[model samples]
Target: MNAFTRQLPKLMLALTALQLSAPALAQVKAPADSSNQVVVPQVDRRDVRLPRFPSNDFEAGLFGGAFSTQNFGASAVGGLRVGYHITEDWFVEAALGRTTVSDEAFTRVLPGGIFTPGNEKLQYANLSAAVNLLPGEVFFGRDNAKPSSVFLIGGVGTTKFNGQRQQGFNLGVGMKVFLRDWAAVRIDMRDHIFSVDLLGKRETTHNLELSTGVSFFF
Candidate 1:
């Protein structure tokens, strides 16, 4: 063997040793003390505020409509209502209404008619309970949207006509659109049923009323 050939074996041993120690040298170069450690930042939190809304629980309004008295034809009627909301979907109301009914049709057949003078004032008072079945929004234009609800109502009260008071039952459906946080417009269709004794016979009568009104909330 020549001198270069004899030194080649030592060179191979040195290279193998260097390769085995390289990984250990790389691990030592990495930081292990607190000064070079990774930091987790701590940040202060802020409070988030919630939005506020209107809280209206009572309302009063006036309404006018056509009242169709079973056999007395239709007449103009006006009413006032005061209501209290029991929940988001339920309410109670007290309503008082008045109308003048003409017995002209009966007069044409019978001279005396149901009422002596052919016309008599009719008044009613009702305590009603209402439930909101459909709650939605009413849009007037691209930029206007109002909250609205469709409700069903029923009640028991008394009707006064011909100098007599009769127990009456009323059922209705209505829609209300909020014009503002404190004001709303409403439309209602209701049927009032009662037993009346006239013409020497006792029979049940159905009176229908359709009305539109405005109300204010507090």
Candidate 2:
């Protein structure tokens, strides 16, 4: 019985040592071949490359927002766009917009000579190419499992106002917040520039527009 009691401690010590070495044993037996093995690394979901959403090649949408000029007053603007994604990160779009200048805006820009404020309109049609600045996911709630993207858009277009047509170019930044894979909310800020033949001299007018609406994927 004395021998057995002494043996018990040694046996217990042996079991304790085995328990400690079990992790080291596991380290030594790590699979040498990666073939036919699945290894997952910790990663932020946004960093993960999500598969391309099927049927996302084409998109069409409408947007409405405020438009204004540096020298002119603010006006209400509405527009629509049809876009085709050339790749995961690139797309081309055609957009059209019409802004109705307020009577106050028209009078504000007119020189103090004799003038009457009448209905005025500013309209534009543009073809732009945009690149995904951030192609997927919003930092906010991903309600309904939808992802959104922010992009930069720039292109050339024509603007007509006061019975005169001017050719110009524009630069814009926008965000598309997806409510569904096939639908999203789009918001944009764009700057327009063109040379207008006011009198005999051509002057450049700087116009800025901000708009938001929704779109559907085809």
Candidate 3:
């Protein structure tokens, strides 16, 4: 054979080796493409905040005004109240009130008055549920304003007067204005109905009470 024939087989073997390694070289280099590579981005994050609300569900207060005993005329009355808010529209309260009713008017016309001298003290206690009927704002000036609400309330209680204990029912309407988030000013009008033995007769009487006071919430 000539030299060209002798080199042909070696050239064929080198070509076969290159063909076998082609796939391995392509697999190593294919991942270098930008589309095939996974790129991680560096990022900075910010904090997020939310709003807050207030919850003041319990309240206590003191009040003073006039109590009009059915026949004894109106007298100065003072009271205190403790309450719990059931919801934004409803609440329950327990109250105690005291006043003195004079029998001076009856004494002038009769020898013996309806009540004795020491028995003129009148006191009452009640547990009541109230509903907010009108909730609004009260403005004092251009820059001052207060939150206010009008409510209807009624409940059963006990009234003691002239050394007698009697079951009573009371109904009232009230308005309250918030002087601060923790304090408020309130005005109320109530009528207490009860039975009492006066001048040898058992009579059902309606005693009207009007009061204003300040309250605190917790």
Candidate 4:
């Protein structure tokens, strides 16, 4: 046999041995943990709930906003309110309101041809039922920062004006922005309807009130 032929078998064995050892040499081994070290598994975050609404139960508040008569334009109005939450979506409340009027309101604004005196002021009291019409939360910013609730309120009561008292009804919409478990900011807009008699003439009138204030709840 030739010399090349004689060395072929040895060369084949060396290549086979290298191929067999390559995989073992290429393997990576993790460093062993020390005896005193604790090994822990990875964890995931869990969901959580937020704080309760301020007026989630009983509530009391004060507000000062704006007032408007059907014919006399807009004026300033203010009021005090107390309420109870019968449920998550229902609330019972009572409010006392005072509004100012101008001389033009009596002379040029009385409906149904009634002529009124220069009414000094108008005062009202109402017992109202409110529903969380859209109690859903509002999220702002990229992270959806804060949430608030909105409601609708309506009811009937009495009004005193120009030395006379009469029956009246009101419908209002409001919002509550919770800052703490016991406090919130309340903003409201309301329309009040009542009958007025001036110079033997009677007619219905609308008074719109808007107010904002703080509320305390328990």
lDDT of 4 by residue, 1-218 (tens): 69999999999999999999999988967777688799787988789898976545889998998888766677788889999999988989999989877656454454533324454588899999999877655566577644578999999999997788999899989998877778888899899999987567889998888789999988
Instruction: For residues 1-218, write the lDDT of model 3, one tens digit per residue.
Output: 69999999999999999999999888784345677778687887779797776678999999999999997899999999999999999999999999988888887888777665624899999999999999999999999989999999999999999889999999999999999999999999999999999878999999999999999998
**What stretches of model 4 exceed 4 Å from their correct place?**
1-56, 105-119
Model 1, span 1-218: residue lDDT tens: 69999999999999999999999888786556887778777988889899987578999999999999887789999999999999999999999999999988886788787777779999999999999999999999899999999999999999998887999899999999999989999999999998888867888899999999999998
lDDT (C-alpha, whole model) for all candidates:
0.93, 0.83, 0.93, 0.83
* Residue 109 lDDT (model 2): 57
Which sequence of candidate numbers ranks them by TM-score, best first?
A: 3, 1, 2, 4
Q: Give each model a TM-score.
A: 0.74, 0.67, 0.76, 0.66
lDDT (0-100) at residue 217 of candidate 3? 95
Best by TM-score: 3
| Candidate 2 C-alpha lDDT tens digits along 10-103 | 9999999999999988878566686878978887566666796577789998899888855557888998999999998999999999987655
Between prediction 1 and prediction 2, the one with superior lDDT is 1
Q: Which residue pairs clash within candidate 2? A: none
Worst 10 residues of 1 by lDDT: 29-38
User: Residue-pair clashes per candidate, as listed?
Assistant: 0, 0, 0, 0
Estimate candidate 4's RMSD in Å.
10.7
Instruction: Give the Cα-based TM-score of candidate 4 against the true structure.
Output: 0.66
Residue runs of model 1 more than 4 Å from their true location after superposition: 1-55
Clashing pairs in 4: none
